[model samples]
Structure formats: C-alpha cells, structure tokens
Target: MSNIRGFRIQHDSLTEKQRIFIDDFSKRYTEKTKKSKNYISSNRYHLCDWMNSLGFKLSLKEMLYPIISHSSEGAYFTDIDGNRYIDIAMGYGVCFHGHKPKFVYDAIKERLERGFELGPQTVESGEAAYLIHHLTGVDRVTFCGTGSEAVMFALRIARGFTRKKKIVIFANSFHGTFDGVLGKMAEDITIPVSPGTTEGMVEDLVVLEYGSDAALDYIRKNADGLAAVMAEPVQTRNPSLRPVEFLKEIRKLADEKGFLLIFDETVTGFRVHYGGIQKLFDIKADIVIYGKALGGGMPIAAVCGRDDVMKIVDGGYYSFGDETYPDPYVIFFAGTYYKHPLSIVATLASLKEIKRNGNHLQEYTNNLTSILVEKLNNLFKQKSVPIVVHSFSSFFRFITVDPYPFVSDPIELEILFLLMILKGVYTWERRICYLSTQHTIQDVEDIVKIVDESIDEMRSGGFSFTF
Candidate 1:
C-alpha cells in the first residue's frame, strides 16, 4: 500500500476472508435472482465478452452483471426479469423530477405533436433561454447538447474574454471529460496526474489543492495570468467535501484581480435549489454552466453569464448586407441541434414546475437526506464499521472514516454496490446516491432499512476495514 498524502493506494489482492464472503454472496444472489441473471447473461453478452476480446478488461462487469432495465417511473425502475429496484442514482442526478414526470412528458408530447426537430431556431428555444436567465439572473444564455459541451464553451468564453492562457482548477473537481480540464494533480507537486494529456495542454493548466491555504496563495500570485477558476461547489463523487470558504475567497479574488469565477453546476443546479449553489450560498459567479436536471432528462445544457462575456458567440448578420460584420476573433459555438424543440419544451416545463413548487421539493429532499445520513451513521456505529455517510442537499455518499476520504477502492465499493442492489437499492460505484421529488418519507425509511441490513450482513461476513 502506498499512502500519498493520506490517500491510500492499495495494491494488495483481496484477502481470503473477502474472497470467501464475495463468493458466498454471489452464490446466494444468483440463486435468489435467477431470472435476472439469466436475462443478463443472454442479452448483455457484449459488455464483458466483446470488451475482453478487444483486450480491454471490464472490471465492473467482473463484479456484477449489468441490471438490464425495462422501465422506470417515479423513483423506481424495473428490470426486464420482473425485479424492481429503488433508483437512488437517478440517472446520475439527471432525473430530478424522477422518471417520466407528467409535466416534462406533457410538454415533450405537445412538442412531438408539432415537431421534434426544426431549424436552428424556435420560439420555445427563446422561451427556455429567457427562463434560464430569469431563474439564474444571468444576462445571456447559450444552449448546447450536453454538459461537456457547455463546459467547453464556458472555458472558451473565459479565455476569449480575459485574453489569458492558463486556467486554475482544484484537485478532485470534475468539470467534464474535456481534454483540456481532465488533468489531476498529485500532492508531491512533482508527479503529474495527466501525463497522457496532449502536448501544450499541461502548460495551460494550474492544479491547486482543494480548499488549502497554499491554493489561495497560488491564486493570489497567479490571478493575472489565469482566465478563470473553475470548480464544483459540491463535488459529485465526494459529496462530503465542500469548500465553502474557499469558494467565497475565490469570488473575492476574481473580483479583485479581474479574473472570471466559473461554477460548473452541472450536478448541483436545480437539485440543490431553484437557482443553484450560487443562490444556496448567496455568492455569484461570472460564468455558470448548467445541465442534467435543466432539460429534465433530455440531452440539453446551457452556458450563462454576463452579457459582455457571453457576446463572444454572437455572429452578426454579414451575408445579408448588415452594417456590422461578424468579428473574426469571436469564439465560434454552434451545433446542428443546439436547441431542439423537445429539449426546449422540456426545460421550460421543468422550470415552470420548479418555480411553482421548488421550495417544497427542496425541503422534502433535504430533510430526507439528513435523516438518511443520521441513520446510516448510527448503523455504522452499531456495527463497529469504519465507514460514514455524508450528504450535501440531495446528494450523499459513503466514505471511509479517516478524516474524510472518498472510497477509492474498486473492490470494496463494488461489493457494497452489489449488496445494495441485492437489497433493492441502486447507487453509483462512487457510493454516491441522489434523492428525487418522487421519493416519499416511507421510501426514505425503506432505503435506510435496506442499508442497515446490508451493513449487518457485511459484518456477519467478516467484512471489516481499518482506517
């Protein structure tokens, strides 16, 4: 095991006790869910077999077969084999109003009657943009197909407006899979986390320790060369780690030094509150990126910011003999389906619903999350397990008890995921779970009960970890 600044990189193979427990649990699960196993084996053969044939090992499949989903409604989904599971993952925080929500569906159905895809512009698109501007208080809004594209555009706008070459990002903060921002930094300062990063990519990135005084010092020193400081207020993978003070400080520095502060609220947008983390914290950002829940499960995302910074995408009419020609240096941002009718209608409907009932939904989910964390911690204490549950708003995760470390071990987290699935609860491998408006108080209680039972079973199987 190599401990890198409190992060344990465990390379040792699974212990004998762990192997025995896993084998026993697998056998029991297979016997109990025979139909599901058969369906998965017959239909989902390509995920593992095909990948292995291509010389790529699929580790997640080795642990558990993919649960072939048949249908989803509210906060639950049913597998093809007639098994139902409570969906706490919620499409990785996309289904805020839950699956097949009536408001979103009705809006989409209406648009479907008119048309699914039109030209580059639509009345609904303008309405959606106006709603986003109204809700976020941003002066302008631009649409894209996905969250990754939105982040990419936001970065381009930042660099274009500030005329700076470098961007500062915090360690463990996930903006997107974009090549420019995917680099990770090690604590040693010598080792690079993104050696495969394309040439010229490393030179433009500055990785800082999340919420450290040293990071603040670095920002103060290099703010002139930085185009923006991009971050997620609450990291999706590690929900326990929130740097509130650091964010406030970043805003102050951005204001003082004339650099942009960008908040990637892709996961925390409407789910945290009606506005976002900005509204929750009462701290504004120069640029904001929103996705996931904005489209109510449709493939849509938006980049909103001050008017001066957002005008980089404006291409004035030149071919039509307008007086103002388009600026050659302006950043180009467009897509074939930039604002599809379905996405726009869904977004508008989602916003209307949220505006009407956002407070009640936020309160319900927040209260449920609080109750869940308390109950899970109590269970962990009772079982003498070195695990803890932490939550921020509707997002929660299970972390090891060692001054707040994310569960980084694949095998350990996979085992827990399988156990939860066996007990009719689903979550991501990061041990992160989400709550939706579709979930009731009874549903929260059931989730807690299942988690408690799963931990007790693990204890009986001799599953223990030392911090």
Candidate 2:
C-alpha cells in the first residue's frame, strides 16, 4: 500500500473488509443520489461540473455527482434525496451569515418589489460604498460583478495609477480566474498556469516564493517596473500559515518602492474580521479587493483603496465649483451590471448587519470554529490520524502530514471526504470547511462525533495512517 503514489484506484490494495465497505457505500450513495447522477450524465454536454473534473475512476464513480441541494437554511442544507447535512461548505465562504440569511433576503425582496433600476445608480450603492469605506477604512470604493472582475480591474487601476507594467504575485495564492493573475512558478521563471494563456499574458507577472526573504529581496531589486504586489493575506490552501512579519515587511517595501500593495481579500475580507486581514495583521495595503461574504451570498464584488489610487476610475474627481477639470490619467472602468439594485441592496443589508454586531459577530464565529478545530484535531491525535486541522477565523481545512509512510495513496484521503458526506457533513473538494454564524455548539459536537466515527470506520478497513 505504501508504494502507491497518485489517485489511482488500486483494487489489490483494498482488503476484504475495505472492499465490503466500498461496495455497500457505493450502492447506498448511488441509490440516494440516483436522480442527480442521471441528471448530470444526461446534461454532460452543456452542464459542466468543473469542480469534480478529476476524471472518472471506479473508486469515484458513485461519489462524482454533487448532492443536488433542494433547500437550505441556517447551517444545514437538504439534498434532493430529502437528506439534511450540516453544511460546513457554507457556499464556499459566501454564507458567513448562513444560507438564506433573513436580512439579506428581505433586502433583496424589498428592492425587487420597488424596482431594479439597473442603468441609473441605485439608492443603495452610496450606502454600500459608505459602509465598505467605514468597515475597511479605505478612502474610495468601486463596484464590480464578481471577484475575478474586481481583481482584473484592481490590477488595471494599480497599473494605471503607478504607471508600471509589472506586478508581483506570490506562489500558492489564488487570485481568481483572471488571465493576468494566472501565473505559476516554473523553475526560476513565471509562466501561464493554463493552456490558453500565452507567455505574453504573464510576461508582466513576477511570481515569487510567498513569505520568503528571497521573494522580498527580489521585489526590492526589481521594484522599478513593479506596479503592485498582490496577495491573499492568508492563503486558502493553507490557512494555518499566518505570515504576519512577512506581510509587514512587504508593506514597508511598498512604502519605500512606490508600488501599490494590493490585498486580494475576496475570501478573507469579512470572514477573518470586519476589517479583514488588514485589521487582523495590522498591516495596511494600498488597495483591497472584497467579495464572497460582502453581499451575503449575492454575486457582488468591490475594490476599495486610497483616494489617489482609485481616482483614476473617474479621472481624479472634479467638482463643478472647483476650477480643476477631470485631470488625472483616466482608465477605462465600467460594467453594465456594476451596481445591480439587488446586489447593492443585499450588500447594504449585509454591511449593516456587520455594523450592528461589529467585531463581536466575527469573534464569536472565529472562537466557535477554533473550538471545533481543536476538538477535531484532538480526536485525530488520540486516534493517531495523520491529518491536522487548521483554520483562519471560521474557515478550516484538513491538511495531511508530509512523509507519512502509512498513507499509500491519495485515494485514501479522498475516501475521507466521501465518508464525511455519508456521515451528514457537507465538505468541499479540498476538505476545506467553514463555520457559519448559524452554526451552534450542538452542531460542533455533532460534527466532532461524525468525524470520530468516520475515522474509526476507515481505520477498521486497514486504510493506513502512520503515527
């Protein structure tokens, strides 16, 4: 079993007990999700479940189709099979307030009843902008449709404001599906991460080791042509990594090098704290992009930054009384659905709720998640499981330990996710999970028990985990 390397489903490695478990599990899961499986298979041409595009294997055939959600409320969502699962996925961090939050839903419904009024500015846009500025301490705020759009516009604004072509991005940080931010480390050079993206698309991108002294030195040496340094304050892939000192040093360099420091806080913004990582780490960035929880599950995004930097969007803000015309170098920035009334209304409701509760809401949720993570980790340790739980605020992930001899194949870890689903805990593809404001102490206890039982079942099947 230790010789296995990748995600191959080696039938020979499975013991008799494991095979029995797999057969039963597959049959039950298939029967439960038969409708979803058939629907997805029939719509294969048009509907692409890209998240589970890891290829078809016998081991994963029954578990491939995502549980079709029939209804959701609070910390639980019901699948089409009428099964309710504790929703730790939490809409991929968009449901900090939980599924179907009343405040946001009411706001959207009210706005819908009144009017959409798409073209002209909505009544809620200013309030949303004001709330964001107040919450994040940014001098200006701009609206966008999604995280990717906000990221692309933020990069353009950085470049336009700084008049520099190159941007510094860190390794192991995801900035969205934007083509410009899709560069990966290739030996000593940075290259496009996807096939369609050419070398020219990533030429201006400088990818460096995240939280390393070498990366800081590189930035210092090449600061002349650098417009911005972008990063996810706490990487989602590894939330335990809190590079506080490293980020502070980067902030210093941004000050000295005349480059804008951009924080891609799409996931971390409101989830980590009311002010995001900037408040958590006490390091300010020139620009910050916010999304996910900003609109309370509504599709909305925002770019907030210093006034001088953001003024380029509207040509430096000239008033009628002031003799000055719109004089600053203007950059093209517009979207047909930039501030859709529903999105803006939802955002307003979310921001207002955050304002009313302040950091207490975040503190309670973070503390709750911390306790849950500790309970899970202690259970893992007591059982000699080769996995560690780490979290940044309410978001947490199960990280496998390195150099463990017992865990032969990655499929063993994959099975853990399936077990989680079967045991009534909805998790993500990468094992990342979130604790929403709606999650209770009882929910945490229930999750811990589920995990303990799941691990015990897997252990009985000779699925190895080294001490």
Candidate 3:
C-alpha cells in the first residue's frame, strides 16, 4: 500500500498473481537472453554498463540484461537472439536518423578506409562547422569526444569569458556526468550528486527549479556573480514539461545581465528540431552544447556560441603572420580526438542530409510521434487506466497518476515495461523513448497495437484499471 516514489518495485510487494507472472516472465526472459545474461555475469568485474547497474533480487535478476544488439537498420534492430524490434529507444536519441543511416554510415566507412591522420586537422571539420553555423546561427564551433566533455568545456569557456565563478543549473535537468554540473538542488547553493564528486567541485553551482517565478527571481537577485545559466531547454526525462516562456525569459535575462545562457542540448539537439530549441522557440542562447543526434550515430559533441563568448577558446581571433596574435588570456582547450576524421565525416554527412531535406525530416517525425501519443492516450482513457503518455517532438514517456483508485499496485507500472519488451518493443531506462526519421505510420500502428495488447493482458491478469 506504500506509494513509494522510487525507480523500481520490490519483488515481495507484488500480489500472488503478479508474483507468478514475474516468475514466469523472468524465466522466459532469461532463457531468451541467456547469452547476454551470461556475458554480463562473466564480465561483472571487468565491464560496467550503467544501464544494467540496477541489481534486483536474484530471482528477478534475469530481467536485467540488455539485448546484445547484433545489427540495426532504419526503425529496427535485431538482437543476438534474433529478436527484431521496432527500436523506439533509437540508441537513446543518437540514431535520430535511425540505425545505420546510409549517409552517415557510408561517410564513416570512407573515412575509415582513408585512415585518420594524427596531429592534423580533419578535412571535413570546416564543412561540419559551416553546417552547424548555418543551422544554429552560432558564430564558432568546438568539438570534443563526448557530451560530458563538451559540457566541461562550455563551463570553462563561460567562466573564462565572464571572469565569474558561479553557474545556475536547474533541478530535474541532467547536464551529462561532468563533475562541475552534476549537482543536486540544495537550500541555497547546489551540492555534488555523486560520491566521487567533491563538495568543492560544485561550490559555485546554484541549482533551482526549471520553470518557476521564484527561480527567476533568485537569478535576478544573484546575476552579478553568475557566469552562466545552463539548462536542458527541454529535459530528457520529462518531455511533457516544456517551459518555452521560461527559457525565453532566461534568454532575455542573459542578454541584460551579461551572463551566458548555455543550452545543454545533448539529447534534444536535432531530435526535436534541426536547429534544436533555439529555432523551435525562436530564442537564441549565448552558448549551446550539442551531442546525441548531432553525432550521426558516431561519438562526437560540440560547444558553439557567439563569437565574443567563444573567443575565450583562443582568447581572441588572430590572423596568420599578421599584427593580431594568439591572446595570452586564453583557456586551454585540447583533446587528442577533438576532431576525429570519422566523427567529422559522419557529422558532415548527417548535417548535409538534414539540410537537403530541410525541416521536413523533423516535422514528419514529430507529427508521427504526436499522432502516436494521442492514440495511446485515447486507449488509456477508453480503458479508464490511470496512465497517460506525454511527448515533446519525438521523445515520449508514460506517467501514472498518483493515488488513483484504478491502480492499486506500483508493480503494475514496472510490468508495463516488461510486457513491452516481451512484445517486441525496445524500451529503455526510465521509460524514455525516441522516434526516428525512419519511423512511419505503420510503425506507429504497430507500437499502438503492442501497447493495447499489453494493457489488456495486464487487465486480464488481475491488474486493476477500473474505478
């Protein structure tokens, strides 16, 4: 009877029928994914996939192994066990163009064949930078190995440019695992969220609510010492909540207060709109960190911004063998694989395709997702289920209403995902999923069908959904 707001359900809390279902489900899942489970157990000490970090009771442990992906194509992937699924997870948004997009894959393959030359600038870097500038209207672009790395660099640039130490972040927004930004909201200032993150790392962080008048007031009161206000524009976990007005206000404040506005668009970048939240809302940010879909399913991230703010990269722009020289007050920015050829080529290919298709690519996918969300919500309403599906562009999540009489157990919430997996849908952690450009009306119909069947099965198995 405890309505615990926790990430998981305890095995002992299930009803007798629920327990029987779990037992049978776990056995079948383990048998189906035996190789993956064995691989996890064998590499338990060596390999660490945080997606499988949640350790359940031994009896239910079999449900934890990720599907060992053998191959993937547009809108679908085949597991090592030959289970092909409509991959709504879409590599957690990295495959916005869908798995193994030919344009990106071919570019990467060509780059690999050409062999990456070390200590030299990549040939495609300029083209990639141009595409980014053309799309986002940013003046400068810098690359890194991952989103976390790009976040760190963005913070460093903000501090260097403004000569200020503090930053403002929002609660319920994830800005990668970078130590400086991994802070939880506190009474006044932010505190480190993870154990290894020292208190001093987040000493200058001010964490507050994402979209609130109180948070805006706090920022206004303390704008002088703040270097930047970093936000996810639209949070990855809770796609339903869109604070366009709040973000526009923040943008205005950033312009007036003389502090940078950093949009951490690691997950939202091209998935929502080709130009990300900036174009979607017609609000420009001082600096934007991009990853996920920007990489074209490759490992890459970028920090881009206004020329003046981004000038901190080399202190100030200088010409070759001219009066202007590299400024001494520059922040050190370097990475061995900063502009790796393969990544650059992939980015170039993806951006070009996006440009060729214009905004239609995103518009089509976003429209499809909206239709899918409406269908699922209609089903929930018709069945009187205390559940609703919310979406922002291609991203969507299921939310269960609290203290609802139709839902007597929290185990039912977890079972929805298990049933989804068994029914050939690729669900990821936190019930977050993304649609790809390859997902068609047919795919949406299939997803709706699977969801309806899962709900009906749960109802028949004594899971309450009636007032």
TM-scores for every predicted model: 0.88, 0.94, 0.94
Q: Which candidate is the best by lDDT?
A: 2
Who is ahead in lDDT, 1 or 3? Answer: 3
Clashing pairs in 1: none
Model 3 misplaced regions, further than 4 Å: 1-10, 55-59, 404-409, 465-467
Candidates in order have lDDT scores of: 0.78, 0.85, 0.83
The residue-by-residue lDDT of candidate 2 on 1-467, one tens digit each, is 32111334534456777788777878877787777677777887887766544533466666766777899999999987787899999988989999999999899898888999877777689989999999989889999999999999999999999999999998778788889988877787778777677888898998888889899899889988899999998998778788899989889988988999999999998888999998888988999999999999999999999988988998666778768887557899889998999989999999999999989889989999999999999998888888888888999888777645324435566777778788899986645689989999999999999888888777776776546
Give the distance in Å from residue 304's predicted Cα in candidate 1 to where it truly belongs. Answer: 0.4
Worst 10 residues of 1 by lDDT: 51-60
Q: List the residue pairs that clash in candidate 2.
A: none
What are the runs in model 2 whose C-alpha is more than 4 Å off? 1-17, 52-58, 403-409
For candidate 1, report its TM-score.
Answer: 0.88
Residues 1-467, model 3: lDDT tens digits? 32212323444455787667667778877777777777778887878776665423333555866777889999998887788899888987889999999999899888888898879887799999989999889899989999999999999999999999989988888887899987877675577777778899999998888899998998899898889999988887677778999988988888899999999999888777888889988989999999989888989999999998888797768788778876687798999988889888998998999889888989999999999999999988898877888789989878777555223435566667777777888877556788999999999999999988988887766677543
lDDT of 2 at 295: 91
